[model samples]
Every structure is written in structure tokens, then in C-alpha cells.
Target: MSNDVEHAKRALRAELRERRQLLSDAQRETAAAAIGARLDALVDSIGARSISCFLSTTTEPGTRDFVARAAGRGIRVLLPITRADGLLDWAVATDDGEIAEGLHGLPEPTGEVLSPMAVNDVDLMIIPAAAVDRTGMRMGWGRGYFDKTIGSMQKCPPVYAVIYDSEVLDSLPREVHDQPVTGVVTPTQTLNLSQTRH
Candidate 1:
């Protein structure tokens, strides 16, 4: 990526993050609950037994409730453990337990490490993104972790990036390496991109 492109991406990320931080605590909680309910409906509609999902951070769309509810309902939810090389390792998500601190200040589950390619076994994948365009291209935080992870999957499943409703965009500063997602799930609806080759 060119320096100008990288700069643009960083600027966008900062702007979107700032917007997310502006949401009040009560508003964030209510939006999270609604997203969780919609997610549950998506899970049921697809009958996804095993899913690869991310653990949400403080300012992002909250995934704690959704992760727990899915687990409680017997869905095999897997959380990513960020590796130093920018690839992610998979582990079963548990509702109760002290989460281990992973790279990028993300908290991960303390469980057995599955192969990085374990994503191929999942029926669905829900990841995080700062913004996504109409063409399914996701402009994530600078690292490109999810892009790398998804690009390597031999047989990828339906992938969705969870974000606040306002994060959806008509276009973003995209790159060739930026992996496009199958759809994007927001507080209100799921935007499925039609050309999901994976």
C-alpha cells in the first residue's frame, strides 16, 4: 500500500473510532442488545453450529452478550487469539473465566489453541471492522489481521463484520489485499454482498 493510502485508512479509522466513543454508555448497551437479538436470528436462520467470532472491545459494537447467549444455546463459539505474526489462533469462547490478554490489547479465551486454519471448519465467521463499503470491502484497523486470516482459508464460510449502524459506507479507501466480506451486520440489519466467492 502507498503511504497516502495508509494515511487515509488511518484517518478513517480514527474518525470512525471517535464517533463510536461519543455514544453514551446507556445507548451503547441498548444498541448491543438489539444487535445481539438480530445476530441470534441470523444464527438460527443459518443453523450455524460452529462459529468463529471476535471478542469485542469497549468502544466497539458489544459482543459480550451475543457471545454468551450463543454459547449458552450450545453454539460452538470460537474467539481469536491474536498472534505476533498478525495471524489469529482459535479457541473456544467461555462465558466465565479470566480472559487472557492478547496482542492489540484484546482479551482472549484461556483455552486450547486450535490451528489457524481452523476457521475452515466453522459454519460462520463474525469479525470486527471500523468501516465497510457497499462492495463488501472492509476497512479495518491498520493491522489487516482479519484480512490475512480470511484470505488464507481454504474453504471459507459466510463472513460478517460487526459494526455500529453508522459505520456502513458507500466506499472506503480500499486496497488489493483488503479482503471483502460476505456481509456486514449492524445494529439494524445484515448487508450481504452478493459476490461471496469464498
Candidate 2:
């Protein structure tokens, strides 16, 4: 990666982190509810019986409600478990699943661990992002986990990044390894930012 792009990404991620930390409890609750509804609708629209979704951190937009509701509806939800090798493992999401802090302090499922290939079966993917540009370029939180996962898939599904409404920008700093999303789901709306997704 070029030094300029790396520096830009670092600065943007820090600003986004600070912004997320500043959200009030009430604001987070409202955003979580709205995000859950939007995600549910997105899943239904795509008719995805199996999907991969990230367990959100406290500062990020919450997906716990959607994960619970999706599991309740009998949809197979795969939660990510980060690996030390800079990859992500997989676990099935359940209403009563135990969550433990995984690598990088991210929430992870404490169930039977599946290989990274488990994600290949998912019909859709909902991931976390600091911001996404109008063209579907996703700026993640400095970790290349999602980017590597998507890039390694033989048949990648429609990947959507969930972020706050204000995080949608006209453009963003891009690197060769930064993966683009098919769309974005915010508290208010869902936007399909790319036409290349199959």
C-alpha cells in the first residue's frame, strides 16, 4: 500500500471511531432498531436463506436484534470469528449462543467453530464498515479481514456494509486490497451502490 493511502485510511478510521464513540445511548438504540428493520427487509428481498453477518461492537451500529430475529425466523446466520492468520472463521448464530471476545476484541460466537470455507455457503453477507462511498467502495476499521474473505470467495454473494447514514460519502480513499460492497444499509435506507454484483 502506498504511504499516502495508508495514512489517509488511518486518519479517516480514527475520526469515524471517535464519532461512533460519541453516540448517545438513545441515539444508538434508535439507530439499532432502524438498522435491524432495514437489514431484515434486505434479507427478505434477496430471499437469502443463509447469510453471514458480523456481530457489532457497542460503538458500531448494532446487529444483535436482526441476528436474533433472523435466527428466530429459521434463517441460517453465520457469525464471524477472527483467526490469528488474518482470516475469519465461522460459527452459526443462535438465540442462545454464547459470545466471547475474539481476536482484536471483536464479539465472536462460542459454538462449534467452522472453517473459513463455511462462508461460501452463505447467500448474502452483511459486514461492518466505517464508511462506504457512492460507488460501493468500503472503508473498514483498518483490518483487512472482510476484504480478504470476499476476495477469496469463489462465488461472492451480495455484500452489504452497515453504517450510519452520515457515513455514506460521495467518495473515499481506495487501495488495491480494499474490497467494494454491493450496497450499503444505513439507519434510514439501503442503497445499492454497485451494478457489478451478480
Candidate 3:
């Protein structure tokens, strides 16, 4: 990507992070509850048994409720383990209490380390996002973790980014390596994209 596009993404990320940080605890809790319901509906609608999902930071839309709910329902949930080289490995999240502060300062699950390609075994994927466009273009934290993971997959399940409703946009600056997502889940609804991918 050009310097200008990279710069624009940085500015947008900063703005969104700031906005998320400004949210009050009560607001965050309510949003998390609503999003958890939406996620449950999606899981039921798709009949997802095994899923690759993320553990969100306090500032972002909370996934604690959803993660716990999924596990309680006997759904297999996998959380990302950030590698030293910036790639990701996988671990099964049996309980939220088992998650501790892991690599790159994100909450990671405690379990047998699944290889990076383990994501390919899942029914669906849910990722964190700074924002995403209607076209399914996801603006991640600019780490390229998901970018590389998705790119390396020979056959990837549907990748969805979870964000607040206001963060979904009409478009975002793009680059060659920036992989668009399959859809986005927000407090209001899931915005499924019309793009085709494996």
C-alpha cells in the first residue's frame, strides 16, 4: 500500500480506538449482551459446531459473553495465540477463566497449542476489527496477523469481523494484501457480504 493509504489507516485506527475507549462500562456491558445474542443467533442459523473466535480487549466490543455462551452450548471455540513472528497459532477456549494475558497483550486460551493451520478445521471464523466496509473489507489492527492466516489457508471458512454498528462503513482504503472478510457482526445485525472466496 502506498504511504498515503497506510497513513489514512493509522489515523482511522487511532480514531476508532479512541472512540471505543470512551465508552462507559455500562454501555460496553449492554453492547456486549446484545452482540452475544446476535452471535448466538448466527451460530444457530449456521449450525456452527467448531469456530475460530477472538478474545476482545476491554475497549473493543466484548466477546466474553459470547465466548462463554458458545462453550456452554457445547460449541468448540478456538482462540488465537499470537506468535513472536506476528503469525497466529490456535487454542481451544473451554472456559474464559482459563484465558490469561498472552502474546501481544491479548487474552489467550490455555490449552494444547494447535498449529497455525488449525483454523482450517473450523466451521467459521470470527475476528476482531477496527472497522469493516459494506463490501466486507475489514480494517484490522494493521498487524497483518489475520491477513497472513487467511492468505495461507487453501480453503478458509467464512471470516467475520466483530465491531460496533457505527464502525461499519461504506468503504475503506485498500491494498493488495488486505483481505476482505465474509461479513461483520455488530450490536444490531450481521452484515453478510456478497463477495466470493474460499
Candidate 4:
């Protein structure tokens, strides 16, 4: 990454950390509702049979409800597990009983690590991001897990970023390894990048 891009990422991270601290419990609930609603719309639009998403931690935008809703609707939901080498492995999440702690304090499945599935098998992948740009570049949590994971796929799935509306920006400094998302859904809107120039 260029020095300028690295600096911009750092600044954005700091700004987000501060902004997160300022949110009240009620505000967080409202934001989650908005995010869930938008996600529901996206799911309806895509009519995907299977989807993969993350179980958000407290510091990130929570998406547990959305995941549950998808599962209830018969979509096969997958969550990313952080492997020892800092790469991602996807595991199916059918019920609350399947989850356990993985590397770096993130959640993973207690079940066996299945073989990596083809990107075409995954209709949608909801990614976690610290920030994203209108052009679809994603700024993750300083880790290259998602980048490496997406890079290894033979056919990339349609990637969607899950974030608060405030975290979406006009531009974000990105490196070549950073994979751009196909669309970004916040509490407010879903920006389709397939037709938008980056």
C-alpha cells in the first residue's frame, strides 16, 4: 500500500472508532433495524438460494438477526472462520448450536471445516468493512483475510458490504490486494457498483 493510502486508512479507522463510541443504545438498535431492512430488500431482489454472511461482533454492525431471518427462509448461511494463517474458511451455520470461537476472538463453527466451495456455489457474500467508497473499494479491519479469501475463489460471488451509513464515503485509499465489493448496503441505501465507475 502507498504511504498516502495507509495514512488515510488509519485516519478513517480512528474516526470510526470515535463515532462508534458516540452512538447510544437506542441509536444502535435503530441502525440495526435499518440495516436489516435493507438486507431483506437485497435478498428479495437477488432471490438467492444460498448466502454467506458474518456474525458481527459488538464493534461491528450487528447482523445476527438478518442471518437468522435468511436461515428461516431456507437460505444456506455461511460464516467465515479465521484460520491460523489469517485466511478465511467458510462453515455452514444452521442453528445457534453450530457456532464457536475461532482465531482472533471471532466466531467460527464447532463443526468440521468443509472444503472451500466454488464462488458460484455462493450466491451472495456479506462482508464486514470499516469503511467503503462509492466506487466499491472496501477498507477492512487492517487484516487481509477477506482479500485473500476472495482472491482464492475461482469464480467470485457477488460481494456486498454491511456497514453503517456513516461509514460509507466518497472515496477510500485502497491497495491492489483490496477486493472491491459488487454493492454496498447501509442503513439508508444500496449502491450498485456493477454499473458505477470506480
Highest TM-score against the true fold, candidate: 2
Q: Once model 3 is optimally superposed onto the true structure by TM-score, how far is the C-alpha of residue 67 displaced, in angstroms?
A: 0.9
Kindly indicate the candidate among 2 and 4 with the higher TM-score.
2
Q: Write candidate 1's Cα lDDT for 78-159 as tens digits.
A: 9999898888889988767348788778878888999788788999999999998988989888887899988898888888
Q: TM-scores across all candidates?
A: 0.96, 0.98, 0.96, 0.90
TM-score of 4: 0.90
Q: How many residue pairs clash in each candidate?
A: 0, 0, 0, 0
Model 3 residue-pair collision total: 0
Q: Please, what are the lDDT tens digits per residue for candidate 4 over residues 40-132?
A: 888888887888788877667778788878888888887787867776777777666366777888866665566555333887888899888
Give the per-residue lDDT of model 2 (tens digit) for 82-124: 9989899999999886799998988999889999999999999
Indicate the worst ten consecutive residues by lDDT in candidate 2: 189-198
Whole-model Cα lDDT of every candidate shown, in order? 0.87, 0.93, 0.88, 0.79
Stretches of candidate 3 exceeding 4 Å from the true structure: none
Ranking by lDDT: 2, 3, 1, 4
Worst 10 residues of 4 by lDDT: 111-120
For candidate 3, lDDT tens digit of each residue in 1-198?
499999999999999999999999999998999888888888888899999899889998989879988988899998899998978999888864487789678888888899898888888889998999888888889889998898888988888889999899899988888888899889888889838766
Please tell me which model should have the higher lDDT, number 2 or number 4.
Answer: 2
Q: How do these models rank on TM-score, best leading?
A: 2, 3, 1, 4
Of the two candidates 1 and 3, the one with more favorable lDDT, higher being better, is 3
